[model samples]
Target: MNKLRLLVDSVWRLTWESREAAHCEELFVPFNPWRESDLCMPSLAGYLENAEPGSSFKLNLSPGKYLPQYQTDKKYEFALESFASGTRPPHVGRFYPKYLLMGYFGNPTPFRCIDRQGGKFTADFNHPLAGRFLTLEVMVREIKQKRDEKGGECLDWLDILTSGPGIEARYQGLPTDFFEDDPFHREDEGDDRAFFAQPRLVSHVDTQAQAIMAALYSRLLKPGLAVLDLMSSWQSHLPHGLELGSLVGLGMNAAELQHNPQLTSHLIHDLNTDPDLPFADGQFDAVICNLSVEYLVRPFEVFAEAARVLRPGGLFIHTFSHRWFPPKVVKIWTELHEFERIGLVLEYFLRSGAFGNLKTFSSRGWPRPRADRYYPRMRFADPVYAVWGEKLA
Candidate 1:
């Protein structure tokens, strides 16, 4: 199986094993829309910031474990446990479902004090972050890379540590185009549904392009860091058998993404429409944008957002191919030829002014033989190109 799917399966098992036996009680995990909600969920620790005023989801929980219980219905209940906040007195007298909506519900279960102790009680079936706006800072802790117990090799785990803010390195005043003609920046002109109409699970680039992607992942991706596959498709083309904390995919089509077992979880979004990412800043150790840079019109704005969200010294990698549909490709790209596309992506990063220590690399392969007799959409040669930049503090 792919790395992302493997991680999800392993994590799901671990979550199950960790919280299998406990007194079951109804719990609230608020779905916070604002605050540090851009980072990927299911990986972040703790209950997230509270949801908006009317948003709430239910989970049946057992004590000492985070995953909610979904099996049998057993009743051996005790009295209610009124929540007490640190540095604040017990508010049992004023405890209403509405108060929880307005107040900061810290890890109410872990290290929380109760008015009447020693008895297990089900608090009101209210959401934890009912009325309050929470400011949550995300941190990715240990990513386990499990290996075989024997002398044989096994999955390697990567424990990501937050070493303060990311490193800040300055660029050496490189002359770059603040605005370049993008070859693939056209707005969808046809019917609204037609724009996102087809779920093309096909890889835009040929085998050469895919091989380059695998090699790139192998060389740049460490064994245990959380990896974000931005502008992702059905296939991440990540190298096989690599250990990763999490391999999250962010793409537009649900069906295409669902088929990808590698994605532990995926967010369906169109960057062309919504430039702001739904992830917390510095949430991932690395972000991979593969074969999709050509389609971005607001490249700088997107890059800036990526830089803002990335940890200092976090890596942002982009790979592109000299292939695109004429109608879908931007005016600029249609105007330029193949080799210049690489120059264009570099200009994109430089123009963003958010990336430091930018570097470029080329994969060596025989260019596809150009077809003398051509059908309209059939191309003869495959193009390969890639570029990378590091986020500065």
Candidate 2:
């Protein structure tokens, strides 16, 4: 008899107040329906209860159905008496630790700096998704049975979902500081030649994150299509055994791209120095950049160039995580909330004016692989964030 059954559900959300464009987000999570009661949210418990191995469906969730505790409060939207301690100077559209306040100053709750005047900062302590609507799309990836549940903490999917996902949408569609103070500036402005002189041959994200990335790529990619692994490394993160027409890797370190076994061919190039791609227009079916979008100093130019190189309807994708060489990441990347980073990437797609069907995807809460080095330091795998759009025909 079946016991614990595995399932994955995705969430879609969009909100626009003053901004003409809608902020879109898609998030996914895998869970055991039988073991975690709270995770099997009441809205879809019956649907999951009857789900079979390949079941799939979508649900339109009300604003506060899953999580109503996030009631809006006028007090949560005012200016603080003084700039809090143990944090950097406040900036509008940025999130800071809530515990820095006099009351819960010890808590790490997220407090967004919605407005900043000449000498004071207006903070909003409301949950990022406090009043926004959401749509939950579920796909049952697997439904294998296991031993009986021995009993454990009932996980709350909504809490995990809301903890840090909805911040991607801007406040009242107001633009964050994406272009202010030199967004592309980095701490390490040294030569790329010296920074990548050696082949590190390491995975930026952990094994679980790698697995999720491979799975995501597997679904988006198909056989017999030329693909470019831009900003490539030794690990392309493509699914093993997946066949493609041709796979070319373009990166700075020759040694690292050379070691990539899946690449049919590889080239050495530094996109930061030259945003223009060497490939001809409409040469490849797809282009993918992983774990390194934060390093693009000339992202706007590079994204437009990517659009030029793709065939009509070709897709461009970028994936990233929280971890990176701190010195090399763009200045704005470190400033926004984790989810807000998606908004920045989405902006790149929008500004290019060369792509459409824009969307962002993310998945979190998977158990961190115990064998991995960061196992003890983090309880879950590095959350995966992705943004992709197809070249306008």
Q: For residues 1-393, write the lDDT of model 2, one tens digit per residue.
A: 242544434332332221323343434455557755445667566666566655766766565666454544632443445566555556677666776666775788787777876656777777777666566666665555555566666666646665776666567767665687778899999998799898898888999889889988998899999999999999899999999999999999999988899999998899999988999999999999999999999999999999998998898999999999988899989977788788788778878989987767777766789998887898888888888889999
Pick out the ten consecutive residues of candidate 2 with the lowest summed lDDT: 12-21
| Pairs of residues clashing in candidate 2 | 99-105
Off by over 4 Å in 1: 1-187, 190-193, 364-381
For model 2, the local distance difference test gives 0.76
What is the alpha-carbon lDDT of model 1 when measured against the actual structure?
A: 0.50
Clashes in each model (backbone N, CA, C under 3 Å)? 21, 1
Cα error, residue 311 of model 2, in Å, equals 2.4
Alpha-carbon deviation at 7 in model 1, angstroms: 44
Model 2 has a clash total of 1
**Candidate 2 runs further than 4 Å off:** 1-58, 68-81, 85-89, 100-104, 117-121, 137-154
